[model samples]
Target: MAGTELFGTIEMVDVFLAMAITIVIASFVSLYRGIEGPGIFNRIIAVNVIGTKTIVLLVLIGFIYERPDFFDIALLYAILNFIMTIAATRY
Candidate 1:
């Protein structure tokens, strides 16, 4: 039973790591879009998307590391991201 539980945990870790990596790669693409966007609207949207993805990555990291405290940080980041996007759009 212990071996089975350990195997399950390891699989969970692998899945979370894979998801984190995928989000990271997506963030890079979003960054490129922000940098080379055709206009201001496109750039702003791309940047917002990057911020959103980063939050997801953070949550995934917390899960992989078995750190529930990191969830608070993720929630804080999410709120900040939302406020920043609104502020940027207004600016």
Candidate 2:
């Protein structure tokens, strides 16, 4: 498949930063939901969503900095998030 469009490195980094900022802003909604949800289940879901976004944000940071090490941090956060969610839901 021949792609008809090409993006410069600077443009690609700009797009990545924009996407990362958008995701962070969007996660603020989930943070608010987690804080003010009417039910515990709703709050749990919101917190989980925030955790998911955090992991994504970590990877995005790695990409923005041109450091692959962030992927490991993201994976660790994913594991912690999963465990915490399971413990929270089970309790």
Of the candidates shown, which would achieve the greatest lDDT relative to the real structure?
2
lDDT tens digits by residue: candidate 2, 1-91: 1222236434566777899999999999788988988989999899889999999999988888888999999999999999999999899
Best by TM-score: 2
TM-score of each: 0.84, 0.85
The CA lDDT at 37 in model 2 is 86
Ten-residue region with minimum lDDT total, candidate 1: 1-10
Write down the TM-score for model 1. 0.84
lDDT of 2 at 60: 84
Predictions: Cα RMSD each = 3.1, 4.2
How big is the positional error of residue 44 in model 1, measured in Å on the Cα after superposition?
A: 1.2
